[model samples]
Target: MFIRFLKENRYVSLLLTFLRLYLGWQWLHAGWGKISDGTFDASGFLNGAVKNMSGEHPSVQPWWGYFLKEVALPYVDLFNVLVPWGEFFVGLGLILGVFTSFSILMGLTMNFAYMFSGTTSTNPQMVLIGIFILIAGVNAGKIGLDHWFIPFFRRMLFKNTEKEFPQNI
Candidate 1:
């Protein structure tokens, strides 16, 4: 009953839309700062993460840290592009409610990544909000592009004659 209310109610959908916008704006601002700075470097962040890679209470997992140190730091340039642009795109998608579930998933991934790197700031709160939005599913995106595009996507992909698309799945 509680889950149904969250996923099927109009009022709840509206609330989620607002929450999506708020989270989107936060992401957009953070990404924009990096992009507009023209000299934003991810090396410092990566280095700091690598430093805390291993211990009894390490920030990052051991094996993952090895991958990060060996693969990521060696190619910091890619991340320099990926992080800022990734944040911007994720924010835009969430704000527009286009591919909302995917956007939220990406947002959650970034939140986890940040937390793993020992950057607590607002990541925990963001993760909670993201999970709620994720659970809300299509209703969370009903007011935006998902309403239109998802059906289009369904028609294009599924070619179902009996029903539009199964939102539950």
Candidate 2:
């Protein structure tokens, strides 16, 4: 019953759009700060996460800990570049509604990753918001750019003309 309302309602979309904007600004600011700052490195955070692995109530999953120790530590430079820019692009996508679903999903993925590393922070709240945005789907972006972009892309790819695309009524 509730699912029907979420899937069918207009109000839900408005709520999701609001949520998207809120989240977008957050991501954008964080990313932009990292970019503008003289120095920002993932090494310290990764080391802290690794140290958390030995405690009785380990915050990070052991597998994640291993990945951090081996792969991420080996290439902290790559993560240094990826995380900030990734956040910025995700925020831009959300703000523009260029790829609303994809952007929110990626944001949710990052939220989970941050949580796995044991820094709770605001990630849980962001995760919830991302989930709502994901559920809202097209309507979440109905008021934004995707309304025009998706259709245009579809027309271009599918040749959605009466003559080129056959009617199936």
Best candidate according to TM-score: 1
TM-score of each: 0.92, 0.89
- Model 1 steric clash pairs: none
lDDT tens per residue, model 2, 1-169: 6655655578887877888899999898888999999498999999999998887788988999998999999999999999999899889989888788899988888899899899999999999888877877777787689889777766776785565532210
Cα lDDT tens digits, model 1, 22-84, are 999989999999999989888888888888877789878777677778988899999899999
| Whole-model lDDT values for every prediction | 0.89, 0.85
TM-score of 1: 0.92
Model 1 regions more than 4 Å off: 160-164
Off by over 4 Å in 2: 160-169
